[model samples]
Every structure is written in structure tokens, then in C-alpha cells.
Target: MAIKPSKGFIYLLIVAVFVFGVPSEAHAEPSYAKYGRAAMQETANRYPDANIIDYKYEGHFETSGARNEERFRLWLRGSGGEFGVRVHVYVAADTGQVRNVELEEIAR
Candidate 1:
């Protein structure tokens, strides 16, 4: 004799397939994405001789009204050696208009 599945077991199996088979919706990038791009572009421009090895978004911080900062850390390799750079892109909190950018070279 062959083992057979009951009607309820078949229904549950079908439900499970429909529930977990389809892929989930795609995720959107963060609001501060523009600032991150600006950081990368500006860093590349400033250090034309250096090649960016890695990029990491640090976080967001509010300084004053309508002013905020997006922090990032970029690892770069140059003729001297490898080093880390902290790039800060300042922007308006509400509008996201870029105000200024500050780049600092950190000791490795």
C-alpha cells in the first residue's frame, strides 16, 4: 500500500507555495543617497592620483535648523600607501540641497 496525503495537507502545501514562492518587492535607496554619490565623486576628483578601494556610509547628523550632514568613510590607495578619508557632505535637512563638503584624510 502507498501512503497518500490528505485533502487538508494538500491545501496547506498549495498555500505555502503561493505564500513563499513569489519574490518580495524591491527596496529603495536611502534619501541621503545623493550625498553619498557626491562624496564619492568629489573624493575621486580631489585625489585623482588615489584609487578608491572601499566606500561606507557612516550615518546622518543634524547640526542646526535646515542643516544636516551625511558622513562617509572611503578607503583609498595611492603612491604613498593605503589610507582612510572621512567625507562629510552638508545639506539642507528638508530640501536636501547640498551646502558644502569637507574631506579629511585619516591616519591608517
Candidate 2:
């Protein structure tokens, strides 16, 4: 007997695809090397002649397992007493891209 797919089955299939189709970059990791590069560019773009001297990744890095979310935090510095910015960024380990960025420290 040739069994045909019911309308309900088709609808369920469609819904399943829709629900699990798009993937979030929640499992990605931030590239420690390029993180500084792009951040320097962004800082320069805003500051204009902002001399970035050094940077460091600070805080705890946690990966998603059962009790943590994948995230990393970094701190950046620039010339002329530029130790006023702490860049908190979250990244997805699967995509290796920044998921969120929080720039703390505004020049006064």
C-alpha cells in the first residue's frame, strides 16, 4: 500500500523547519587577534588620530554548557592616558564572531 503524507504531517514538517531552520551564533568564539584589529579601527573611526597603544583581555571567559553563556571580555588602551575603555564583548563559538559589544568609557 502506497502511503501518502497527510496535510497535518506536511504542516508539522514545515513548522519544524521554520522553528529549527535559522541558527544563532551562540556557539561561536571571538578571535583574540582580530578582535583588537577591528576594535582599533572602530576606535580610530570615532576618535580620529586616537593612538591605541596596547590592549588586554580581562575577566572570565565562559562557554555555554549548563550554567554559563558563551562570552568574553576585553580591555583596550590608547595613547595619552587612554586607559579608560573596557570593551565587553560576547561571541558565539560556532561562528567565531562577536555577538554583542559594549563600549564602556566616554571621553569627558
Candidate 3:
């Protein structure tokens, strides 16, 4: 014969699950994602007429004096033409604030 759990015990279990939910591992967003957003926004700002067709994350690197850069290449199509731009989004290492953005046109 099998014994059943008491209603009070089942109630407690349901309450616990409702309050805490199921246990699961936490996932963190990659560091590049934040900087990548900046890159995308700046690219749009600079090339207002262009539509980004492709994006590639090249690398993340630290620069002099608490500065870091997220490098990416974006291909865009606009009224002017289709081209590629290498974007560098430099940010403050501690605060994640934008320090500078640099764009260079490249042959695609």
C-alpha cells in the first residue's frame, strides 16, 4: 500500500513553488552585447539613410586608460551604395559608458 501526502503538506509545497518557482541556473548576457547595441545605434545615427544588412562581431579589447573597444563589421545598403563599415565602440571599462565611436569604410 502507498501513502498519500497530507493536504497541508501539499499546500505548503504548492505555496513554496508559487513563491520561489522552479530552480534554474542563471544566464548572463555577454559583455559584447551592450557594446554591440552602442555600435548599432551609432551606425544608424551616422548613416541615417543606410540599412544594415549584416553584422559581424570581430573582437573585444582593452585600450589605454580604462577604455575598451568592441569591434564589429556591418554591411549596409543605402541610396549612396552598398558598403561595409568597421565600427569600433570604445567604452569605459568600469561604467560601460561610451567614450568614442570610430567607423572605417571597407571593401566588401
Candidate 4:
């Protein structure tokens, strides 16, 4: 007589493959690093004479019906004084091309 596997045993094998075969970090991407570099460059352009003391990612926001942007707050110190500025970097989600940069000084 030929040996046969039970239905329960087949299901258990399938479950084990699914539980251990998938990579945990498969969805991780380096896109954030690129965005951070762009944000810092934008801040440097806005305040060429200032030194960047610190910065924080403020998350994502939609600027218009068709455009999305990443916001960052950069703390800077220059010859004049120390202050914080909000930098908005608009980039294409698909191509990663920088569309525009906008800066606003936050009240100290």
C-alpha cells in the first residue's frame, strides 16, 4: 500500500512555509535618506551663512490637489541670531524629482 499524507499535515506544511519564508524587511526603502538630503540642501540654500544645529522631520502633507510634500524643521545659528525654520520640499513620489522648495522662519 502507498503511504498518503493527511489534510491537516498538508495545511501545517503550507503554514510553516508562509510563516518563515517571507523576508521581514522586504518593504524597507532608502527613499527617506534621499528626502533628508534634499531637505538639508534646501535649508542650506535658504540660509547660506547659517550652521545647521538640528533638524526634525515633520511628516508628510499634501500641498495641493495634485502635489505632496515632506516637511522638516531645521534649527540654525548665524551671525545675526539663532532661530528655527520650516522647510517644505516638494518632490515627485514616483521619480523623486524635487519640484520646489519653500522656507518660513519660525518665531523664536
Best model number under TM-score: 1
Candidate 3: lDDT of 38? Answer: 83
What is candidate 2's lDDT per residue for 1-108, written digit by digit as tens? 999999999999999997789665674565365655555555556556456555665543665632222222233344555544556555665665766655666442
Segments in model 2 whose C-alpha atoms lie over 4 Å from true places: 1-31, 63-83, 106-108
For model 4, residues 1-108, the per-residue Cα lDDT tens digits are: 998999999999999988797756766664555677888888898789999999898888876765779888889999998999988888776676778888899946
Query: In model 1, where do residues sit more than 4 Å from their true spots?
Result: 1-27
Steric clash pairs (candidate 1): none
Give me candidate 1's TM-score against the actual structure. 0.73
Better of 1 and 3 by TM-score: 1
What would the per-residue lDDT of candidate 1 be over residues 30-50, giving only the tens digit for each residue?
777889899999999999999
> Rank order by TM-score, top first?
1, 3, 4, 2
Q: Give the TM-score of candidate 4.
A: 0.65
The lDDT of model 1 is 0.91
**Model 4 lDDT at residue 67:** 70
On TM-score, the stronger of 2 and 4 is 4
Can you tell me which runs of candidate 3 are displaced by over 4 Å? 1-28
Listed per candidate, the RMSD to the true structure in angstroms reads: 5.4, 12.3, 5.4, 5.9
- List clashing residue pairs in candidate 4: none
lDDT per model vs. reference: 0.91, 0.56, 0.88, 0.83
Query: Pairs clashing in candidate 3?
Result: none
The TM-scores of all predictions, comma-separated, are 0.73, 0.44, 0.70, 0.65
